[model samples]
Target: MLIEAAGLCAGYGDARVLHGVDLSVGEGEIVALLGRNGMGKTTTVKALMGLLPAMAGRIHMGGTDVTALPAHRRARLGLGLVPEGRRVFPTLTVEENLRATAVPGGRWSLPDVYALFPRLAERRSNFGNQLSGGEQQMLAIGRALLTDPRVLILDEATEGLAPVIRREIWATLARLKDEGQAILLADSRLQAILALADRAVILTKGEIAWTGATAALQADAELQRRHLAV
Candidate 1:
């Protein structure tokens, strides 16, 4: 596995959110983390990214135990995140955002990112605050790719975007999958996830309710209703 998290338990101050959660992402695999609101999806991302300290359990990246490492250290170890809300630096230009965390000898370069997201190229000189929501999301993904990460985790990759923009993002993800990138995606769009992800992990009330191939998840309507239905 490229990323392995076992028995992960974490939360905000005095309010635990995750309870012994376990997940793994292999190379060239796309895994979807699904759940309704406040079910610990973002919390899991935070724990995995070291943004929130894990109160229990372990995290291993590229087979190295890194549960105690800081966020920057984990990023250096090849864990990249395109966080929820597309948190790009408002003061930085699109080009600068991509350049800020770029590492030498990486497979993804500015040109490659530009090619993947031509809109970014068109607005390369624009500040992050000046871009539309979809453009900012693209910039976030581009910035993460520039790190040459072993695994990419995207929280709500297509949330709050126009249908056309959402389709574009999904297509981009498909291309990345074809090129053997490992992705961990969290989104509310069940259909899109079923089409894109190899496996699915359903979180319900801070615990993994189910984990299986996408086909199995698709076939189980009752499971979806119990945990995912709004």
Candidate 2:
């Protein structure tokens, strides 16, 4: 497994959101986390990223125990997060934003980022705040890719975008997966995600309500009605 977490318990203040959540992402596979809003989806990602302290459990990357590592350390260990929002540096130019957080692993460089998202290359000189939502999102993905992470985690990657932009982002993800990228993506588009994800885990009330192959989950009407339908 490229990433694994078992018995993960995380929360804010005194309120716990995740209850012993367990999941894994295999190398070169896209694992999707599916659920309604407030179902600990983002909380789970935060916990895995070590942003939300894990009250209990283990987070392992490439079979090494990193449960105690800080966020920056984890990043060095090849874990990258795109986060829920496209949290780009508003004050920085596109090139500056990518330069500031570029990793030295020598795996992904500025040329690679520009090649992956040519649209970003066109706006390379534009300040982050001046780009459209889709452009900002492209920059966000580019930023994460520059880290050359072993496991890429994205939360709400396609949220608040036009249909064309969402499709573009999904296509980008597909291309990355084709290039053997290991991704753990959380999104609200079940049909779109299911099409690309090899496996799916559904969270209900902070627990794994259902887990199965992506195709099986999509075929399960009962499962959809119980946990996915809004």
Q: What lDDT score belongs to each candidate, Candidate 1 first?
A: 0.93, 0.89
Report the C-alpha lDDT of model 1 over 1-230, residue by residue, as the tens digit.
99999999999998889999999999899999999988989999999999999999999987699999999999988989999999999999999999998999999999999999999999999999999999999999999999999999999998899999999999999999999999999876687888899999989888999999999988988887877743
Evaluate model 1: give its lDDT: 0.93
Q: What is the C-alpha RMSD of each candidate to the true structure, in Å?
A: 1.0, 1.1
Top lDDT: which candidate number? Answer: 1
For residues 32-102, could you state the per-residue lDDT of candidate 2 as single tens digits?
A: 99898889899999999889899998999887898999889888888888988889999999999999889
What is the lDDT, from 0 to 100, of the residue 35 in candidate 2? 91
Candidate 1: which pairs clash?
A: none
TM-score of each: 0.98, 0.97
Off by over 4 Å in 2: none
